[model samples]
Target chain A: MAEAEQVKVLRFWASPWSFRVELALKLKGVPHEKVEEDLANKSPLLLASNPIHKKIPVLLHNGKAIPESLIILEYIDETWTDNPILPKAPHERGMARFWSRFIDDKCVGACWMSCWTEGETQQMFMEQARACLRILDDELGGRRFFGGESIGLVDISASFFALWLGVLQEVAGISLINGDEFPNLCRWIEGFVASDVVTECLPPRDKLLAVFQSKKQAILATKSMVY
Target chain B: MAEAEQVKVLRFWASPWSFRVELALKLKGVPHEKVEEDLANKSPLLLASNPIHKKIPVLLHNGKAIPESLIILEYIDETWTDNPILPKAPHERGMARFWSRFIDDKCVGACWMSCWTEGETQQMFMEQARACLRILDDELGGRRFFGGESIGLVDISASFFALWLGVLQEVAGISLINGDEFPNLCRWIEGFVASDVVTECLPPRDKLLAVFQSKKQAILATKSMVY
Candidate 1:
């Protein structure tokens, strides 16, 4: 008898959270099937796996379902120790968690809002995004990546900055960063996108743009109706 | 020459987050001094330790500071090893993080709102609170604690319900749960509060009542001005 097939990921193409787990698995050389979820009409498997949130990027490992991107990242790191995501030192691990969480809590939603709303609301979110970018740029501190020499947990956690934010900004007609404004982040994003694993797993830019373009139109239409 | 002491916590007395770290340290028996910060006028140490969030419950270990309660709990569990907060199993640890993040993201602020709001707003928040409590009750499912037979990370993460939620409900004159509605949660709270280490560190209910009462009054006053 052979060992059981171990891993599977339920994901949506355009979700950064979903992409986080996908990238982690790819980087770790974990062989797993990707089940693309239709967010508009969620699959039974996705719902059953994550009944609490009914959200995707749920990693099914050895018959257990693990949700939340950061938690999944930790699970992958712990389960497969080779090519570690988090640093071995407790303090460094703590800092990595701090920045990763900071991105999730502060930057991600604000980045979304920056791309969706209009007038004062959009401006406010843009400012929030710019402020977050400034902080992250400073945190990068001339390093090649958030984890210093190479991409690690913090870098993966902030991967949305490289792909999603740029696409969303273009689609929403908002400009939060420029090469001059966030030079360190600009350099980091270039290196992150250039990485083989990341480039392989990232959704194509054109497809991402098409999805967000439609989403933005829907948001603006809804806003107009409310006004 | 003597080696310097290792652990210190920058905390504010009334903060649930600060209480979380305190409880974890006490349970782990990691001896440390507590420096209470004035939240109104945050100290330079607090600001320096957690420059990004600038919030309390910053745990300083041998000159390195780890902010965020859940992160600090992980750090404590990793460093101390004895009286482990999280389970050793990968899947169990993943579930612990899932529920912990769920409570942090969903329950805490909504629980606060359920207490402070009035009329329909209060009613809506109370419904949200009840829904969360229901999920938590089902999750508890006859276990003595969220971590099962012993107090663990999930149990500690939810320690708020034992102390603060009861206080807040009393202060706001709203009842989200009765014994009949959420038997597991009621039992869990009683057990949690009665535990030796929890009882030892928990702030006196009367003092907690005083603080929340004033805070509730302020909220109502602000609402009046807006209206």
Candidate 2:
């Protein structure tokens, strides 16, 4: 498995999912070529590589494209095998994988939850999202990180709360990840951003805020246009 | 590692997630014991095993319990050096995982989209669910199965869609898994149900449909009572 040819990753600049793959590659200390995809006009290579989702954070190891951010993380962890992302014990590893998947499934697109719903409906899902955060914060619960001690796979998987999308609370006008409320998660976020790996890879705070502003505007525009 | 004891899994009756672990176990031909959880009150063992979710299916390899359906699936594949549920190729394996996670994330509650919402709100989520199903159907286009040829982890992972909750479509008065539109998927479903591993483990369809019906009615009754 160690021919060790250079790796290539197709990614979007502002996507949290893309950020996940980027963080993994950097943590594993793997050298990778990054190709950014345009959402409006996707590249042919991106399309060909990921014909199904036709989305970004597709890792090409020796010219084969792998879609899905979590999958990419797993792939990176397996390939490098040092500074292991997932726990070694099969069941422990499974617990980590489950939570990571839960985050991706339940919380990954929460920034978009408000965008996708309105009135009472939005309120319902928003409450559901808060409960998810509460559970996550509980999961963090005095731990230095989700992996505990060193920031590992699940922490990287959930770094969205640590980075850009966290600012969406302002844009969406929801205060879910409150520091006083989710004390452990708040500390976890601080530790995550403070880490050398995260600080290096994270987009500038102002830039991320601007992205959130634009996305919020777009979402409002979607509803506005519908009306 | 070679001397590690065989794995065992804690599970619940009528849990699709448990079914997920079961299928993965059978597919991989992993040597394991299945401990069924009593959801009526929950067992102390189950509580200790999955203190977080207090749920099943939890995978125990060498006496550690791993919670969450998807995570257990990964653990089974990893621990058992038998038939691999995940692919040997890293990226391809990621794709399998990604799809499985997508199914896990999007397939909420067996049948109903929203028990509370009425008119446009429910309609919107219904559209979203349709979009998801459309994507899954397209991804499974022209293939013998989701895994291609033989049933793999993804097929086992998503088997709930075919057997258990497929009846929920009847309960919901919505038929998203249309045989005519998704002919390949329909064929795959039939093939899966006919398979020995899948067939032996499936809850009787009549029982499943009855439970789903009772559950749906309960949801409706609870909503009505609240109003």
Candidate 3:
């Protein structure tokens, strides 16, 4: 019999990007070993595997390294035929890619910066973030999830909103995702986190909260020192 | 006989992102109608087609719109399999996507900004742009194309460097792509723009230069008014 194809993931615990890759793997029932990296002092394997960005999560399948979480997700879906993460039709697949990129390009950074910044800057980013959330809520409409019945590409890509954004908002003492303002997205957060595959792999909420809280505290300390 | 599929592209002539979509279609021999958008006053059709971003080029096939250039390119490839722009292997396809994104996320904006900014800011962006060019040159290595013998995803995505960057650099009186510094990249650009499909679709060099020159003049006028 042929040896099982070796699969491994290089990841940091607190990254939502890493979470996306893990979720995709678990969803597909791809049994892979996980290697946690010290991002502050990255390993040689990590560096050699991904020289371009030198960032995780890098997916290694039979010694072939695939970097970038979105790219990794697509690679996994393409390689493993069962439990498809992306839709079948070309147009639907294109839309899936479009929304996934939208969440990354428009939503994530704006929402993230809204937490880290203050005063006018924070307000600017907050508005942008809110606008994005509103658009997302509209897109979700009456669908149970962004992927309809299953948690697929956009849901996986928007995993940051399902977990990290909530934690970061709490740490920063902001409420970007009010149930009233973004009812669909709020409901999505509930459904997405409670899903089995996601629940198994997500970093514990308290741990994520602690990480962001300390980071926020450090940022505040730096601001006080400067001003 | 059944009616032929109605294929259209909402585009602005000078936009490299738009150019990418056009080149892919032409390379695939897919007949398409081009509707040039008045970017200052965008049409309702363009707005309706891509409600999320409202930017071109939007590919309308049988009236189903696909927005974002890279997404459109993928859609085009999947929908029409002839003259494949992406490699057949899953890993190679993933790499193609990675490099295409790298060019967009890292190279284009930095190179464009390097042309427009001045003094310390210009120097900072210039260094970043140069670093990106060096990395791209190294990746090109000895390959006749980034696609290794034909124009493909990375070659198409990096089209900005082939035409627009050269025009912008000349207009700004800066020399970022010296033949010695990025010989492989320079050679790739030469071959890429000289290729039949690319050569046929590219905007006239003199017209592009005139457009950038007027924009630079307007920017200088605004700067002088401020400082």
Measured by lDDT, the strongest candidate is: 3
Ten contiguous residues with the weakest lDDT in model 1 chain A: A218-227
Task: For candidate 3, write residues A1-227 as lDDT tens digits.
Answer: 99899999999888898899999999999999999999879999999999988999999999999999999999999999899999999999999999999998999988888887899999999999999999999999889889999999999999999888888889888999989999999999999999888899999999888777767767555532100
Tell me the TM-score of each prediction against the true structure.
0.96, 0.78, 0.96
- DockQ comparisons of all candidates to the true complex: 0.89, 0.64, 0.90
* Per-prediction CA RMSD (Å): 3.1, 5.1, 3.3
* Chain A only, candidate 3, TM-score: 0.95
User: Between candidates 2 and 3, which one is better according to lDDT?
Assistant: 3
Interface RMSD of 1: 0.6
Question: Each prediction's Cα lDDT score?
Answer: 0.87, 0.75, 0.90
Clashing pairs in 1: none
TM-score of 3: 0.96
| Position A65, candidate 1: lDDT | 98
List ranges where model 3 is wrong by over 4 Å. A219-227, B219-227
lDDT of 3 by residue, B96-213 (tens): 9999999989998788778778999999999999999999999999999999998999898998899889998898899999789999999888888789989999999998888878
Q: For model 2 chain B, give the 10-residue run with minimal summed lDDT.
A: B108-117
Candidate 1 residue-wise lDDT, B52-153, digit = tens = 988889999998999999999999998888989899889999999999998888987678778777789988978888889899989998999998788999
TM-score: the better of candidates 1 and 2? 1
